[model samples]
Target: MDEIRKNPDIVYTDKSGNRNYGYLSLGCDELSVLGGRSPLQVYSDFMRSFRDEFSNLLGETIMEIQVGMGPAGELRYPSYPESNGTWKFPGIGEFQCYDKYMLLSLKAAADQAGTVGT
Candidate 1:
């Protein structure tokens, strides 16, 4: 994870100016070795790790988390909140996940925002 965070090539800037920090770039086949844990569990673990390692970037709290997954596959039908996208985790802000491509775009929208210099 540390290595992925340090790679400049992984940072993508969309046309709308949204900076997407790609955390994982793995295919489902490659990721299937996790040994039977559901996709929801995998996402939860990732979130926990991100919160632990990058708490400073997340600000006071995680207000919400949005996760997207492919329609059909091992990860399909993964368990998650059903709040119509308004889910909130007070104190923490927002986090968006990309499903087709395994990438967690961390949008650090706090007073302190910038790349972690290598």
Candidate 2:
């Protein structure tokens, strides 16, 4: 929350120009700017620590570990924000790529794939 408060661009912006704070958007890309780590990096570190600390419980006490990405730990975009009243149940969620970071990433991908025009 503090990060978003400091850098509003971290949040997802819809086509209608509304900022959705339902979860951190592509802001995860610029986390390093604020002396923070990316979400994937943080998760990787956590798995490493868990493996190191619970080496003995891998197949006994700890049977398995479930991992997820994105909001609510689910690998999905924050398309619907009920709190903002811009979306509702049963409605198709909006795309979450209006942020600068996401746009740059998309452009890079397109360029790499030769999909972007010169």
Candidate 3:
């Protein structure tokens, strides 16, 4: 809706005709802004970020190899409310900032996604 697009925050929309909350777009540029890199490299940069951030949080340096050796799983959000519309599931705020910056390359990937959890 105009409210979301006009607002400073990004908005998600499944259909241009309907602006529901279930649509979750990945914004990478927001994450790049945090990491000091361009958004174009988000897909490849995510691993670096995951490793660096994990170490920062854990207070230990764990190489990508170590982390890669572990089982890799996918992380996704459920449907939820958007700027002014309500959605099926809420979002994770913890990773919002990261995903936002890293996903700017794709227009579908907006600056906003879910409610909060990151």
Candidate 4:
């Protein structure tokens, strides 16, 4: 354990020939140095690192949407309500149907522009 803690890159072999890899923790200074500027800056750096590490493999970009309550406690909802009248619950929560449509429109535009995959 001591050896593994000292050198995390090292691989150990037991008497039974089973191999074990070491574990390491990241320090704040190391994170700042490697990530550069801030953690968000690391996103662009990932492309270069991934390309260099996996030159022979193909890579693609992906975009995702995250839905959550806003600072004012407002929640997002689907563009259109269910026609079956099942979603007509009262006082359940605030729903912003337009936001979903906006996101869908943006996604459609991105797809048409070839920025998003099929």
Candidate 5:
């Protein structure tokens, strides 16, 4: 939590610079603060370790090993985070792609299409 607060580049920020307090997405190539590994790579390593350690019980004890993405493994941004106390039932979620890494990619794509400022 402290690291997220200190590193604004790792989270999404609103137009006024208020961050949503969510970590970078899986697709983000930016190295995470933990062990300087990307989130996806870290997840991969963890899954590999789990598989290796539980190889003997794969079919007997473990019926399935489900992998998930994003908040709660839903493959989406933490748009309606409950920690903020700003969201309620039926409330529309906010977009969460304002992180520095995403912004850089967006800028690059926009530049490629000649839509830098638009």
Candidate 6:
């Protein structure tokens, strides 16, 4: 909440004026600006880290990597090779394609009790 509100470009607000939360599209970071990478960079980094950690700890199929965010944020879906093509699991940054929320979700999912395998 604090992070989202700090950015002038992205802040949570409501007409009610009592309390509010809204979505904000954050641009890439310094590295993203210097290297010209899109939000996809962060997203992918997270995916890789999530998969590796989950596999090492929980050892589950994970079935698939569903990376995205909620109304408060975004963890945009795995970007296709050509905006219409799906490639292998890893991409440019490995875990660079995800945001904080996605990371948290992955942790929670891994912590849950399950078959821990396919």
Highest TM-score scorer: 5
Worst 10 residues of 1 by lDDT: 73-82
Clashes of each: 9, 0, 19, 0, 0, 18
Please give me the total number of clashing residue pairs in predicted model 5: 0
State the lDDT of candidate 6 residue by residue for 1-118, as single tens digits.
Answer: 5544543333222222222123333322323422344346756877788767787555355555554474434644323232223235455512222343333444556668552422
lDDT of each: 0.40, 0.74, 0.38, 0.37, 0.68, 0.40
Model 6 Cα displacement at 83 (Å)? 31
Worst 10 residues of 6 by lDDT: 11-20
Q: Please write out the lDDT profile of model 1 over residues 22-76, one tens digit for every residue.
A: 2333323233324454334677888799788978767456566555544332333
User: Candidate 5: lDDT of 51?
Assistant: 91
Candidate 1 to truth, TM: 0.25
Query: Is 4 or 5 the stronger prediction by lDDT?
Result: 5
C-alpha-based local distance difference test score of model 1: 0.40
Candidates in descending lDDT order:
2, 5, 1, 6, 3, 4
lDDT string for model 3 (67-91, tens) is 2211133244423334444433445
User: Could you estimate the TM-score for every candidate?
Assistant: 0.25, 0.71, 0.24, 0.20, 0.74, 0.32
Candidate 5 lDDT, 45-73, residue by residue in tens: 98899999999999999988776765567
lDDT tens per residue, model 2, 1-118: 7776887667788877788776566646545634477755766788899899999999999998987765577877788877788888889888877776666677788899989632
How far off is model 2, as Cα RMSD? 3.3
Candidate 4, residues 59-100, lDDT tens digits: the string is 443244243442234443332223324236453532231222
Report lDDT (Cα) of residue 8, candidate 3. 24
Each prediction's Cα RMSD? 18.5, 3.3, 13.0, 22.3, 2.8, 19.9
